[model samples]
Target: MPSEAPVQPPPPIKIGGHCFEWGQRSYVMGIVNATPDSFSGDGVLDPAAAADRAARMVEDGADLIDVGAESTRPDHQPLDAAGEWARLAPVLRALREAVSAPISIDTAKAYVAERAFDAGADALNDVHGLRADPALASLLAARELPAVLMHNQRGRPPVGDVIADVRAGLEESLAIAEAAGVRREMLILDPGFGFGIGPQQSLELVRRLGELRCLGRPLLLGSSRKSAIGWALGREQEPPSTRAAGSAATVALAIAAGADIVRVHDVREMADVALVTDAVLHGRRRGDPA
Candidate 1:
């Protein structure tokens, strides 16, 4: 008999009226940095400009918009709860009114998440994976919001093989999210690319991303315009703004490796990339044109 097809994970729970059906097609999450010191050089300090960017992302086919006030770049100065809230609140409020797509607050602080939720944000994109603040999980559970738990260990040296290292870290993160009353359906996993880990390790994780499916949750890949991509392209000495094409290449590879959503800075290009990739991987008909 022919081999049985792999069992796909259940559909993702709806967040802010968006149904993320895993394996149907990959989704795009656009990045909207609201800080003055974003590493990607795409920061929009003005609330109005931030809102406009969010709207444009939605128009560019972004399924979700992630707004971050504090930069997650390595060794970056951390923003306090009040400061982060001040930057995120206006953007979240404006995007809530300006765009129909779900708005994710990319913050590790519980206080900021609370305020963002109150300001109409729909999800929490925690880079610390609920480890930064004890109250973060409780808030996410209480609000019953969708979350992206990423594995980040700032300044930690690589311990073993890249995939094995990432897998172990994500397993711990998954346990924390589950223990905090966050349902499996409402949780997504990210294998922290470009965070603490080396640039080569980041590229290795993208190539070996399929292994993460053993956790049985949707996987989100956020390699857009990161320094690692630049390094892979021999542009480590250059700026991040030039990594768009490299980012697209990684996005396509991640999708083929079982990424459910790709968080990106250049939405228009990545959205188109996802469309063609989806058609090739999941939409190709046997008798269709070559």
Candidate 2:
């Protein structure tokens, strides 16, 4: 007789109007960069084009659509809240008219989040994990909206282990969210790939992602077209569009590692990768020996 496979956890909790079930099936959150300088070269200068791309992503199997105005790429100049809102507001409005998938605002500024939410964003993906603006947690708590708390290490770490560092940062952020009255179930944790981690550190986190799952919050892996992919593929000069296959590979790996949500640029391809990987890793076979 053969041994049984380990049982995966239940799907992610449905927050607001979104269901983020994990393990059962991987969910893809498509990226919609509303800026002209997006590293992925997918940003749409025209609001109509942005809306159309978002609608296409929804039809292409995206479970969510993440919209951002500023480029969070390394060395990119950050935009002010007003500037960011100016670029994002039109896209968000247009998307609301075009697609039904929940909209997530990728921002750190409370002002931007507030405006985006009012414009129909259902969730918040704070890269700074609420550390940049302490008031953002309160805002989320008040709105009862789901927020992804990504572990960021903008400063020097006291320890050398990236996993330990990330765990600590996430715990601290979760504590802050709790203190601010945010619902525990409304929180999601991300390992913060490429935010302040090097290529080796990022890989190690992906390998040890299961440890982060112990935190009990849904784990969101945003390794799509990230700098770490470029480093691993030995294509430092290549753009994000060139990293699609690499990103798809990571999406599959991340799903196997127990990631609840995958933030990705190439939604259609990554969604297919997630489905196939999930079938292999967790789906039941009809005639396999057990």
Candidate 3:
């Protein structure tokens, strides 16, 4: 019998003042969509309510909070810069007062990212991988904030092999980031599940996620309540709230495959899921001292 390969631990990544020691523990990023049209259906209309939710997520063990003002679901209408800023400003301000965890702004617009960073967001998660606004790469570089460069092929057909295509695309994005003066330690790569992937491709990505760590950056998986789950469950038309179990499954699998961070909406439940998955993968029993 062949010997099993040794697991490769991800390198530590720092964003703002937080240090994420990947492979030691899985970090959790809670979602806070502040728009009415979020595909996840958890958007809060009130800024105070959003702030409260942020506090609850932190209490529930969220290592970070990702606040988004616009809907990025396929075919969703895009919000203007001013509109996005208006929706995110109050919530960002409120969250600043509520939690100490690093906050990330999910936006493709450079202007929106600038304002959010100015208003206290510690990171930027650009779904477009800085392609939507080339200037965003420069903005992230200038601000010296860590950014997630997700692989998104919005208008293309599924590539013949999902993982290969994702790796190629992310390599290009990394080149762009470097050209913009972003440091290698400041980059996080997301495979962009459901952004352009079909059901099979999404599943394969989760199953083979370890391959992505070869890129040498911390891996962030954001499969929470995504459409890919609905597709896999034969409920593509169902609401996001109904996909918790599937999301949990992905979270566990992602951790097993070497994901450093799991971004989720069901913070409390998924945090528990990450804890158990980490214990199993790393050979630590539950309640063992860290």
TM-scores of all predicted structures = 0.94, 0.92, 0.94
Residues 203-257 of candidate 1 have per-residue lDDT tens digits of 8878888888888888999999898988889888788889999999999999888
lDDT of 3 by residue, 37-120 (tens): 889888896889999999999999899999998999886788899988998899899998899899999999999999998889
lDDT of 2 by residue, 6-101 (tens): 356644666547776655666788999988888777778688999999999999989888888998777678888899899889889999889888
lDDT of 1 at 24: 72
What do the candidate models score in CA lDDT, each in turn? 0.86, 0.83, 0.87
> Model 3: residues >4 Å from true position, as ranges?
1-10, 285-290
Model 1 spans > 4 angstroms off = 1-6, 155-157, 285-290
Give lDDT: candidate 1, residue 186: 87
Ranking by lDDT: 3, 1, 2
Residue 75, model 1: Cα distance from true site in angstroms: 3.0
Q: Which 10 consecutive positions of candidate 2 have the poorest summed lDDT?
A: 1-10
lDDT of 2 at 37: 86
